[model samples]
Target: MGSLCFNDGVQDDRQPWWKAATFYQVYPASFKDSNDDGWGDLPGLISKVDYLHGLGVDCIWVSPIFESPQKDMGYDVSDYQKIYAPYGTIEDVDALIQTCHERGMKLILDLVVNHTSAEHEWFQESRSSRTNPKRDWYIWKPPRYDAGGNRQPPTNWRGYFAGSTWTWDEHTQEYYLHLYASEQPDLNWENAETREAIYEETMRFWLRRGVDGFRIDTVNKYSKRTEYIDAAVTDKNSPYQAAPEMWCNGPRIHEFIREINQVLAPFSAVSVGELSNTPDPKQVLPYVSTRARELDMVFEFSVIRLGNGDLFTGKYIYKPFTLSQLKALTEKWQCFIEGTDSWATVFCENHDNGRAVSRFGDTSTPELWRASARTIALWQATLTGTLFLYQGQELGMTNMPASWDISHYQDVEAVNFFAEAVASRNEQRIQATKHGLSILARDHARLPFRWNEDDNVGFTTDSAKSWMRIPREKGISVESQLGDRTSVLEFYREMLRLRKRFQGVFVFGTHTLLDRENESTWAYIKEGFLTTKDGHRMRGRALVVMNFTVERAPLVDVSAALGCAPESTRLMVTTACGAVRGAKDELSAWEGRIYCDFGPEICI
Candidate 1:
């Protein structure tokens, strides 16, 4: 290995696969359909290896595909080691993994270990009798009795999907804990036998089968407080309560992760934990710290919180995510992780949230919509971490159709909120709530990946009824944008290609937030060195300046730091093509650019 210019011009060189890779997330059920079943299966995904390769991503992070009761759409795992029947057989999954490797793309599966489907064999046996050998595999406590001898739930904790966290088990005469749906029972990580069994049967099982890595689902909620305490009631009538302090990043979370990491280390497996709602950067560092032996990185929700209108309520409210807010959150993470062994996952949208273009972009006009997509791409691609692009993101997908009825929404979160709102019988509130949800629903991203402008948006045969409605009228199909010079898809392709061309500057350069107090504009500088194969070296500075708002903003000068006149800097990439100007040129609405003192050729 040669020297990494960002670390030094001569000696330090450590190239972890994840550190240099760009990740693409695919919601398996919405990617493709080979047999016209209206549902995407492993074979359907296997058939799209070329398309993924063409997109220039280094790896694909697939959502859960385990055998499930479909209670939570595959999150409720009945058998951790088996593939869902509708998705395909174990052989089909092996084939998909093999195909991705053959195409030079690594595959990362979703690891849902926090809970298992109530229909799981282990759960069934545990619920049968108190003397069952597997009785301790899940949480179970005797019901609390009131003065009148009336039975009550063990605790007043609320389920994430609504209702009480504890469900009465008549047969066993006890109450079981479920943080999610009642069909999903929380696994007892406290049991040494349970943890070891999961490691052997699930973790090592997939690693032995050539899995590249895993995206641990709900990882922050894995370890609950040993004492089952009632969460303080904030709203008595609301089905859910605020209890993150008791469960998130709990006592043994770091210990559990370190043990899991020990198992993954031998296989060279990478992992990223879904740890949302952890506000303190200090609190989040341990999960991804090299010294901690936990995860490669963890997904933080600071940016997501800004886009999510209702932080406390179910993202059922609409609040505009402003330019200033985006800057403060991103800069904090970037600065915090710099020079540390820990890392951050830079992404704007995924299966759990609406499209970034819909949440942050000006979708009211076609040019602004496209430009917003480009602006987001520029921001993510040049960030100091692994980049993740959800399916259809490259094509600049918009929110689901405004005309879509609540009936068309398929996400459990949206459905539950709608049902609860309707029960209130307030027409004004119902209309207002639904209106906000129209822009924030998770289904907006869960819709089928648009491959072409066919009758079914090229996801399936025209006659096949899709599992979820496709917004065909959006006209944002991959095929239509594949070769269009100015299309969002092409813009992404260019950004990715440039990242590969200048990996050191983008991946290892020291990050510095510029114009920290600016409200209308957000800017950052990445300074590092570029080395060539012939051993020639050039000091490089990459400047990312953006007008995040909808109004033109005057540019500022950074020529002294750039070591050259700002006007002389090379424009490596930009949402709008024009002369390189660092002093007087005003950025157009929603416009951004990547400026480098030295050209990308210096890295080569």
Candidate 2:
């Protein structure tokens, strides 16, 4: 193939290695249990390096494995340098890194510096006394008293988990802020010394240990609004209010990210920020733009947040959405990043989301399950960005059985929400909340990996129990689908291979959404230039079509849209079974296809 060319004065050849790489996110707790301790550890992850290498992944992003009290899992870090005992020792991490490097794959760790466990030494010292030198390291305020002399939290802002963002400390007679759980107190970025300490302890500590980079958690929430004012009550039913403006995309977020970039620049580390709070493309561009010198890329949550209710209710109340809505949200991001120096992170499932096959596709039948999984994979693989595949997703994993009760949930977010529902004593509200949780709870993705049809699904010894409940879905394990040519696992492997083969078109080509109004069909064309071995340059156009519904759908004539004859288009890949005679006029249920047309050699 020929080299990629741009209309402006940009060179695709100069792109960073990460920009062209595929990432696989490993959520350690449920990945694999090497010691049969019911929890996945670093050693177990190390043993699976070869499996990821075989999957065509170029990078591995492991979620938090740091020493913690496990209040919010490992998100509440108590020791930045020490490894979580359940996950394993530092030696295991070294082995995992060396193993990944041997196979030419990079490794990134989750950075959760926005807050630390209240048990952290710094927090312990800071809360000991108001005069302690470390008191300023965390955000703290004096409690406000009402007319009746009852002490109240400084502000009416609600925490991400629930309740007020502040927790009163009787020892210091002051309230400290925590945007998340109270045990996870928010760090004060206003303190220069605090910022310096976090950088030295977290970022530099790992970079020196040979880790490639970081997946910064809540990256935009580090710099928060300093004014300690009450958030206007948007939901009057609740005492506290959602305050994204006060704590998200704060005044100093860019400055903080620039400092982080400086620390990462020396190591040439890649930074993919979790910018959940900042959804606007214009607002997020500076963080990832080449000229801005901030993050390399950031994960946007708009697509994931679709079909969800308000912030307080969150995903507890499901709202029906159309394919047009999905298409518009996707196109918005794709077009926003086209000409800009910034990049995007293409993903449908993660540690915090329900399985893609269950949420976005049909799972009413076995055939539809596999087809929809392949369709979703095709859609993500063809997008212009870094791809991240969560574990078990390649096997078309679905959510936990809807019949399971709240006792099976181990996630703090889900358990807390359920507790609130039960506390209300409203049976109707309780039933609705439980039904919603069955569909959208984060615990759905926290189940043990299904390796085979053994007890505990081969995640652990047959005699041992896994950390979370294993799904009862049949014929969805790796061992079952590994040898099947038409299985979801095989389709993922094939799709990823094709993506790597045509990186120029799939990763850097211009994207144009076709038939944006269609609710059942998603069609888009990617146009770019490819070079031949004999030094001739040719323009290449790739058309991707997907039937997003569970029924047959007629797609737009992409050949006519691209001004190319039907016979000239070559069938590159398809999820359809059996032999495809020629160009297709309509797609079968959940079918996806890609066609490539390389016109006669042309010079720009």
Candidate 3:
């Protein structure tokens, strides 16, 4: 929440607050629990304002806390205006908003308009009868009859949580579409009434409550291919087909986004869309482009999908990826955003993704774990975009231990996938699926936040069991790392501080990836200009080098990478222990360093 002074010791009013801000994503259920109800609530988050403020985060994006069945962990909203009872009341949220702003921070709720819970009044009314006026509010289609005279779903497209995308409604004698879980029915954006209701009831209702903006959930899935044709079979094991093209970024996506933008413009709000299934930068540009006037930025999944399997298996089936591949995908986005009006959102871990340290860092040994965690922190902090840090990421929290069985997972996606795998009755398949889930399951990120090494990791009191499994791991808690200079949490603080110190270079600079083919190293240079207080302009560049392997990495020429002399560069920060002797000929295992040549006066 602290002001970011870019150049000349003056805050850059030209840039939007979000353009250079660091956002912290709080999974309400896992963040903290103050009521001792085994679930985290708004009051618990309110208690941590000082913690977030100290971490240098400017905005907090809380994943869905609306009234829900919690079938999808709050993503399935039963009521837009009401707060989930377990999380807290509307009054608690108002207090949270006030608490955040009182400390100079902003709060943005998760806008999940793509779907509503089956128990929602709107969906209940829509399904009451075929002639109901709200029947068109959701995507409802008559079941198709097969040649054998058996009823089938409207189409053969698979739902995101597995099974057919359409669920049969016996009362209405029709099938309703749900891109995700059957409990979450997709809204028909083609209906003007539905769109307007979302804008007025869901969006405006919160904006009027002083909420900054929204992190739009499934932003690109608002529109769907109305043809209702069968999708091509991408996964032969399943009867339904995996067709993102049929549901993601469909015909009317931009129109819907423009309409939402109009709603946000009056409030001067910022939006970061969760744009899925559109990996191509060209496809992503329209949503975030200033000329398009859609969203402020977007969360693209190309880099996150590096080691993921096919669309159907997704992260549940993991594949190995080289550092070169990660560098290429990252640079592709970084280069694509340069000079364009469109902006980017940089993140590794999120509510749906596995822990960043487990996925991107070496967690085999304690030493490697801390080093790799710090290395990933440096990598993310130096990227040319708005940085989003997931809860517990700063403390190097990792995925649950491999010994944990399928019962530990509370995520609907993981539970469904495991059931399907077990139903297959193939031991090989079940074991492989379980192994993959251990490495990449969404449940890993949903574990209760480790506040300390207390019972239930200090997420709640010992009398109340956490809603989800608390990891048995030790030492990766806020209390444990609070003042330890060598801890991953401390490294994150230093990295964020350095990022603020060189905001001009880190935020507005041009990103250039170096050693494109290097498998053991990831290096990039950020170049920009900063003006001194006395009206003197100085050019600055930062060279970031990271060793992504457990083995020592080959030497990287610091001077050649940044096109500056070695003497002019200063060792800004490093993950390696002891004082670094300028630029070394070789980097130790899992080492990361940042070198800047912005002059002594400005670098400090």
Clashes of each: 0, 1, 0
> For candidate 1, lDDT tens digit of each residue in 1-604?
3434554443335557787688999898899988887888888888887887988888989899999979888899999888888788999878988998887789989999998999999899999999998999999999988799988888777666667788999998999988878999999998899999889988999999999989999898878898888778787667457576767888898889888999999999999999966889889888888888899978887886574554444457566666778888888877788667787778888888788888877788877787788888888888877888899899889888787788988777788777877887988768866987788778888888888887887678853478987775654888788888778888899988887667667766668887778888888988766777667766678888888777777875646546697576886777864442233467887888877888545744
- Looking at model 3, the pairs that clash are none
Encode model 3's per-residue lDDT on 518-562: one tens digit a residue.
Answer: 888888998876655555557688899988888777767778777
Instruction: List, residue by residue over 1-604, the lDDT tens digit for candidate 2.
Output: 2355432334556668887789999999999899888998999898888888887889999999999999887999999999999899999989988999998899999999999999999999999999999999999999888999999999999887878889999889999999889999999998999999999999998999999999999999988888889998787777788998998888898999999999999999999999876768889899989999999999998898776666564557667789999999988887788778788888888998778888899888998888889899899999888888999899999998877888989888888877777877989778877877877888888888888887778788843467787767788998999869889998899988877666767776778998889888999988765555455555678999999887788867767866788888777888977752123678888899988886434222
Q: Give the best candidate by lDDT.
A: 3
Winner on lDDT between 1 and 2 is: 2
Task: After superposing candidate 3 on the true structure, give the runs of residues whose Cα lies further than 4 Å from its correct spot.
Answer: 1-11, 579-583
Per-candidate local distance difference test: 0.81, 0.85, 0.87
The per-prediction CA RMSD against the true structure, in angstroms, equals 2.4, 2.2, 2.2
**Candidate order by decreasing TM-score:** 3, 2, 1
